[model samples]
Target: MTNSLPEMAEIWQQTLNWQPSDHQQAQFQRLYHLILEGNRQLNLTRITDPQEFWEKHLWDSLRGIALKGEFITSLKEGASVIDIGTGAGFPGIPVTIIAPNCTITLMDSTRKKITFIETVLTELALTNAKTLVARAEEIGQQSKHRQAYDVALIRAVGTASVCAEYTLPLLKQGGLAIIYRGNWTEDETTGLENAVKQLGGVIEAIEKFTTPLSQSIRHCVYLRKVATTAVQFPRATGVPTQKPL
Candidate 1:
């Protein structure tokens, strides 16, 4: 099953207007295998097929930043990034691979998953990334982590309000939070705007795009932090999911 993943260099340029370097391509291939090997011991991810993994995990992760390409590149070299609830390191690992200068924190509440990611890091020699095993609520209130990141990435976590509560608190003023979702609606957008307003952030943009290979609908919500988030946010463990904002 060597080279199970299709090399879609032209497709990437056509869709995202960018393609990975040769080394980045190799790293992506390595990451795929690492995740596959990890699944046997842990329930890291269910999308194991090469094509599925390429579209959902690898391509989809970078697609968010590709939408805000110029703005994301404006972030200083060595910018701090946190991937909250980064299960199996989707988006985080891909971001790390692409942005070699940025320092990425791959955080997940599950210890086994973090352990598996740690191995992936070592195997990939992904020195720019680090793994953290902690909940978003816990870190959002911590002195060292609160308002410490330039970018926060979250995917498939919870509701829009819950995502805002969990991510807005971790971003420095002027920082950006990119939330990935499958399906979105006008009502959801209204609610999300209110939630982020309460958290000292504004909805900068809500980009809807179809996936390159499958043509699946996806949305990338960009929240820009304008002021300090209230201290009550992230609101105790289970509170964000249970009560949201």
Candidate 2:
């Protein structure tokens, strides 16, 4: 069952001009099983159909892997990465699947989500991935986690400001925090400037691309951490959402 999924992933990768290595093939197989099991027990995601999984779940997760090649290349093979608010392992699991050399920490506040991720990791034989059942804000402040990651990936999570607060603190200075968002206008970018600045990040770029099958416009906001976040940031969890910086 897992074997067929990688064949599908390879086809998808070929469509994007990417050729998966033998190791990547194995990873995709693991991802397929993980998603399948996760779907059975919890609302990890809504796109359960196999075809929809290929397009919406697999491809959507792989987009970050595709765009951040340069960043991934710079990391030490098996460097640490953290995915905050990793509701269903978007980007993290896919990234772990494609980039076998990198170790990933998939963190979500919900215990069921973490359990689902753990089960997938174990089933897929993904030795480099781990799941944390904790809030992003609390993890970002822990001495062990703070400024510990080489890259931080987030998706469809929150406002740019709030996202930055949650993600940037977990990154070492000069690391990158890639936020996946829907299409945004110039006004939205302008609105986020102060929050980005406040969180010690600079908007490096706002990359726009269309989904392979859907042709839906999507945006990836790349922010680079320039300095340490002030202690006040990530403000008590719910605060960041209710009163964004």
User: Largest lDDT belongs to which candidate?
Assistant: 1
lDDT of each: 0.89, 0.76
Clashing pairs in 2: 78-101
The TM-score obtained by model 2 is 0.89
- Lowest summed lDDT across 10 adjacent residues in model 1 is found at 67-76
Report the lDDT tens digits of candidate 2 across residue range 90-117: 8788777766688899988988888878
Q: Evaluated with TM-score, which candidate comes out highest? A: 1
Residue-level lDDT for 245 in candidate 1: 69
Tell me the lDDT of candidate 2.
0.76
lDDT, residue 223, candidate 2: 82
TM-scores for all candidates? 0.96, 0.89
Runs of candidate 2 with Cα error greater than 4 angstroms are 1-17, 68-71, 75-77
Quote the RMSD, in angstroms, for model 2.
2.6
